[model samples]
Target chain A: MSAMSDDDRRAWAYLAAVAEPPCAPLIALAARYGAVETARMIKARKLPAGNAAVLTATQARCETDSASTDLETAHRRGARLVTPEDDEWPGWALLALDQASTSVRGGGPLALWVRGPANLGDASAVAVGLVGSRAATSYGTHVAGRLASGLADQGASVVSGGAYGIDGAAHRGALATGGRTMAVLACGIDRDYPSGHARLLEEIGDHGLVVSEYPPGTTAAKHRFLTRNRLVAALSAALVVVEAGRRSGAANTAAWARNLGRPLGAVPGPITSAMSVGCHQMIADGQAALVIDAPSVLALVEASGHDNFVRSPATPIDGLPPDQFEVIEALPAHGGLRVEEIAFSAGKPVAAVLTALAVLEVKGLVDGSSGVWRLAESW
Target chain B: MSAMSDDDRRAWAYLAAVAEPPCAPLIALAARYGAVETARMIKARKLPAGNAAVLTATQARCETDSASTDLETAHRRGARLVTPEDDEWPGWALLALDQASTSVRGGGPLALWVRGPANLGDASAVAVGLVGSRAATSYGTHVAGRLASGLADQGASVVSGGAYGIDGAAHRGALATGGRTMAVLACGIDRDYPSGHARLLEEIGDHGLVVSEYPPGTTAAKHRFLTRNRLVAALSAALVVVEAGRRSGAANTAAWARNLGRPLGAVPGPITSAMSVGCHQMIADGQAALVIDAPSVLALVEASGHDNFVRSPATPIDGLPPDQFEVIEALPAHGGLRVEEIAFSAGKPVAAVLTALAVLEVKGLVDGSSGVWRLAESW
Candidate 1:
């Protein structure tokens, strides 16, 4: 593909700053007349045929030209502007946003601000977006970390927003494993919206990628995060909600994932945990698959044409007869019990329990050495 | 329906004892030729036209007739035989067994030995079976108990296998609420397999019901529990698994529920707990709905014709604009924060945070009396 000219790059940057993201009219204008020409027409207050809506969409910021300054600020921060004209643009990944229905808010970004050595296109091609609550519980953070680490180890990049709790844990987990991770920001790529994660974001930028649609000097706002969520969902091959409250930004990302037709999964937590309320509801409503680990996440990603992934772990007595299995179940995890106690616990006749114990002893699944039967230590 | 004759009850008692349950051939024989006639034919070793499987299924016990003695024993223990001829028989509930696919083991029982004040047919008409691991954790037992109590309070009978852990918790929960509960036992109605629950069983028999297909002297065995699980599923409108290990008996009951065309639900738990493995797997595989409360269980029961049951509990800031909602979310659950701290936490501008705080104060959702904002106590 031909490289974008300097004029086209500056034009796209101006268009990006002129309107809030998801400006369909501006996107259409640029597509029809090219970024450079579209910028010229808007700057001169001239209409390109029948595109009056573009003027309305860009009316507020069209007169302010900060394209050059924004680019310079981005360069100073070691970030670069990645326009649709750039060969490194994740066009394939964001293509779904173009086809999304109106109900799913936030269309594709006009241009992205990227920082880091990792390639956005390559990383997103086989990535999993892991998002969740900033007020997540310890259990949620633990599971998120383990899942992110496992996913990274399996050669898939971990993607997440750079917030605290689950998001921070996921990014840290990927970093701990010396693997690629992408942090999509709600604010400018040069700024850490959650300042507490400033060093973490820099670490991610040094080894992975930090990306955003907002330009330099743009601060994070509630609406911007909503807009940013669409990018996280768009970039990933699949999305998993690690933990979420009833009303959480992650839920919005999950919605975007669904709207984009990306496979979605939710990790289950204790029914008593308020943090997991959204996840249970999503699974119950059939909006997401119940994912417990990294393999389950991979299963969701490869669900279309792959063989089923079984999650049941085998036990020592997997194929034992009912009587023997019951005897084994009756034995306490620790300590030992007499034959009659075992029989009573298993709800079986003494003779049957004795026979089961004999066979179990032979199979090395139980021990009767202390005149009381107990599960084998290996068990 | 007509009352079953003493002779017919005796015949059914004999048939129930002669075969290991789920004897499809004997069930067919009784359906084709009445229970009394079928018993006489089996005793005479006479085969009906082209019916030979019955001989194989009953060969070991057909000649050892215990009908008279078993009935006497049952009567002494306050247990009464209820055959298909009896008006109190739950034929409507068990009919699903006759229509079930062969892959689902266990067929309809020939007769039930019941001891209780509750009518079997009436109670089974509006019931939910609750089953789970005998080695359940406190969380599992807690959820099971709460769900049982709620279901019972809603005029639905709670049915369970009457074992320990989750099952015992369910039974106790229903009883504690002065609600009806039925214990479908793996052993004889007259005997307590888990002797520790003898008093609990007596209480259930006095106020609810104790049901079993096994004869008075019969004891519980591993296979009997599997066979009994089918009865639990068949007798209820829907079934829920509260918690279960990988090879749990509750999973078998859930399968029976699915096979019998009964709606099935499974409670979610911490992923770190092995006790919740089976439950999570069932939900992941779409074999069971994720149910966290009694209403969700009721939703499963009425899923065929009812409005969707929504499980989300709304918060005070539910309808707030993005800025206001984010500000509310940033506030600590306890105590208050200064405007600058709130702004930083919410990732919003100071002016925007002030505007949201003012609106929230007017709505009585936030308090700003001491230059510090906090969520209203009512919230």
Candidate 2:
């Protein structure tokens, strides 16, 4: 496809800055008439036949024209405007947003300001969004990192917000594996809202992508992050929540994923951990499937018709002789038990218990050390 | 309803010990002809016409009749044989087992050896089974204890196996709350399979019930535990697994619950914990709902038409102004954040953040001890 015309690009940039997203009326107007024509109508203060909703949506910022300056600032920061007219735009990924209900506050972005060499449309074809709470636990970060690395190793790109905690860990995990990742920001592409992650965002921009719908110099706010979440969900084939508190922003993203009909998976954590409350709630509400590892996340993506993946099913205990299996089951989950204790627990004679333990040890199902027998860690 | 006659009780006891249990053909024969007639036919080595399966199932134990001595021993031990003719036989609870497919090895027990003040049918009218691995983690036990205590507090009987770890914790929790708890054993009612829980079983017998399908001298075996699991599912309105390894016996009980059309629930734990693998698998496979507390378990029981329970929905971060809500969200899950850090994270001024924190603290939403602000633990 031909590159977006200069007039269309400038018009899109202007429209993006004029309204607070997601302005359903403005988005609808732009779709009916081309971005360039819509911008001309708005600038001339012309009322297009009985469309009063657009006037109310755009009146405040209609006279403002920072398109030239915004484009210049983006170019200086190594970012460029990508409209639906551009071949690199992720139109397929964002189609769901255009069709979603207004109650969900879902509306496609006018254009994306992207900073990276990777093409957004190509990267999104096999992408998964890993999102969760900024106030996350160590367990959450560990799982997020491991899952992101595994997904990247499978040749799938990872998408996430460039925030603290779970999001940062996901970005770092993908980067560590030298795989592609896209960081969609709530603020301007030039600004690092979570300043601590500035360097991480720079690294992502260098190797993958840094995207935002906000214009240059726009600051992050509560409402903007809520708006930005929809894009993260729209840009990925599937979404997995690693961890989240009851009121975490990740929950908003999850709602958006559901609204877009995306396959959603949530990682289960200790019920005692407050940070995992949202994930547990999602699973309990039947809004998400429980996912423990990367293979499970890939399975969700595969369900969306991106690729075929089959996680090797865990092998259940089988084929062990009765006594040997009893001995393995008798050993405590955390520590070793004495031979006499094992015998008592298994309801077998001490000699028989010893024989069974020996067989189990050879099969790598039990460990007998310091005269105490325990189930092998891997078992 | 009339109490079971002596002859019928003796015949049921004899039949219960004649087969290895869950013998579909023998159970069918007993149902077709009365228990007394079925016992007499087996003792005379005479099969009903066209019933070769019954002969193969009962031929080994047909010659031995311990009903007289077994009844005397049970009387001396404060146990009684409650048969289908008895008023307290829990017929409603066992109806599903009789209707289930033979492939599940689900045949109603011929007779129950019960020792307790509580009536079997009445106790099972509103019961929830809390089952899991003998080798469970501290997290699993803690959750199990809390859930059991809460369920008991709500006047629902807690049911579990008389074993160590999660089962012991659940039984003790119910006892501590002065609520009824039933222990269904894999061994004979007179025998203590897990010797460590002998005193716990005695406590349950004193306050609630100890039930078993096996004869007085029978020992616990691997296969017996598998058969015993079905009864646990049948006796309870719902089953909640606390923690289970990949091949824990609790998984078998879960399968039985599903087979019998009983509502099933599973408590979530850290994905890293091997003990929770079976629970996560159950939830992922859609075989069990994700239950976190006693109310959630109660919801499952209520779903089965046993009782009504309503868990208080968690209060999400709402009704707060944007600035205050942002400040609260900025605080980390496990620790506090400094005012300046909160301000930076929330993209608000330091003064605005301080004001929001003050209002939040007054409302008991945030803790501001040691000059750092954190969301209150309860929140």
Candidate 3:
């Protein structure tokens, strides 16, 4: 694994610049000299005479120092770095790079600082990303734990943010059940935030993996947390949100997963629960998939384990039942049909139509206004 | 409304088996010619060999009871014997009658006792049934309470078994919300069991209603409790079980509701919860409609309110996205395809395939298994 030619190292360093562009100037330097000679050209342009200001400014002070620090931390802990050119690189990460090329926010780290022997690049496997609100209900925690254990029981490794509530429960569930789990960190892997979970992290490191984009000594920052959400979404086969607030980090991860074409699954909660609103929204939207059990989740991963991502639905409707067809046909040409007219036209009594209409509303078929049912914009 | 003729009163009583059976039978001397003839020929049946077994039983029991007994208790409490001849009799109760006139295990009550002014005979009205486990989880209690309140908010009279757990929670929720609720007891209405709910029952009696089929002073028996499930199912437009065990009485009420052609609704809980297993099985078997919220329960009621129970799904499935049509058509029937395969089949790029699949899955046009995707069941 240690044997590598200069070309391989050079390609990794080049991809590092493209993959982890700190700013515009750094991107320009990488673009100019193809990484290896960029420092010289940048120095020649910005030297008191010939100093690579763009390349040296970032790599010299940040990349070099960070690498040394990371290496020192890595040496003390026997960890290593894996870049795009590494034999251990997964195609899924490369797919992320391609996606980042089209997006402004970008994909992930140029080099992942890893602390365990996880051949994520190995064919036919799944990484389960379980996330939820920090203030999850006990029910949510229980569901997360069950999903984690079930997925592990099926030989799938669990991946989650190491936060409390659903995240904590998921990791602990895997650990307690003697299963593999990975804790992807926004902060440096060594400096664990929410101090109480250090033991859990240590256990995960022992049997699973803990990898981060940031240098080992870097402190946890809120922005870093969100930025790392893409990695959590990208590295896994599917993202399962056990619980989420209306605007939660779990929801953010789900959105990214959807945008990245990764499968997204969410556990349903009580409709009245404010914490589950995000999940409801995701399921409502054409984004996340809905699963009630771990088998449903595993079924998804196993079916697409060999591929980068699974295909979408292949039908017209979730397959509308007969009554739904009637109500839909009863709607007016432009505006929604009055509930009265719909009932009459569908030949269903008024009460019967009303219930069908509500189901239609949730499914985003007919939008109701002033007691009339019209087709939804989404429909 | 009080313009009932003598014939009408007799007709009502005859339907409820209150005075006499509809069929003419050999009376002691004349024949048992239903309530009509009982009104005209009370003397036809001498004291012995009358078809009024229930009536004779009631009358003789009164003789054994002294002035200081339950009869006095009933009189003091102002409880009235609401024979089916009364204008306030609930027509919904007729649903409990054996279709073939078979000897019902629990036949029509000798007389229904009443203490409330709410008319069960109103055409534009409803009774909502809430039932579940005696040993329910907090989640169950919470859902039952909210569902009951929602029904009451929608102008329904809540009906439930006067049992512990979900039933009590529903009753309390309805009472706290200033809604009409009825506690149907297996024992005499005055008697309270599962003593912890005595205060709750008293409150229901004061604010809503407490009803019993048993004559006053009857103690509750285990068989009677099971026997009581029919009234809970028959008396309402729809029955919603908040949480039920595999063998809970709630399941009995649900089965009866289904068999009676009433819409049956069930609240879903965490799949891991044993309490929710009954609910899950019910939904899966199509025995009970899944109610996600108050609105869904209301929808079920509205759909089931009329004589014809099978209606369009309260929720309609939105059709598939336009762009996904080509993708859907191109999908092989074998199973879910990898993203690239679908994109190639549809003559689209990987990103387009991903986006379309997400939207399609949301529309329920597709179901993506682990890494495999396929047409949804509906499709």
Per-model RMSD to reference: 29.7, 28.7, 20.6
- Put down candidate 2 lDDT per residue, A186-224, tens digits, no spaces: 999999869999899999999999999999899999888
Cα lDDT tens digits for candidate 3, A99-186: 3434655544556666766664541146778999989998899889988998888777788888889988998888778877888887
Q: Which of the two candidates, 2 or 3, achieves a greater TM-score against the reference?
A: 2
Name the runs in model 1 displaced over 4 angstroms.
A1-8, A31-34, A101-105, A304-379, B1-5, B27-41, B46-51, B101-105, B305-379
- Best by DockQ, which number? 1
- When sorted by DockQ, best at the front, the candidate numbers are 1, 2, 3
Q: What docking grade applies to model 1?
A: medium
TM-score of each: 0.76, 0.76, 0.60
Q: List model 1 lDDT by residue over A118-168, tens digit each.
A: 877788878889999999999999999999999999888999998999999
DockQ head-to-head 1 vs 2, winner? 1
Q: What's the CA error at residue A352 for candidate 2, in Å?
A: 83
lDDT of 1: 0.84
Candidate 3: residue B40 lDDT (0-100): 36
B1-379 in candidate 3: lDDT tens per residue? 2455646443332322222222212111121233444433333333334346544533423224221344345556655445444666563354243221243443334345454445545411477789999899999998888888877887777889878899998988888788888887887766776678888877877777777666556688877776677667767778888898889888877876775557887776676678988886676455676676667777777655443222233323212333466567557766778887776555456787888889878877788866777878784
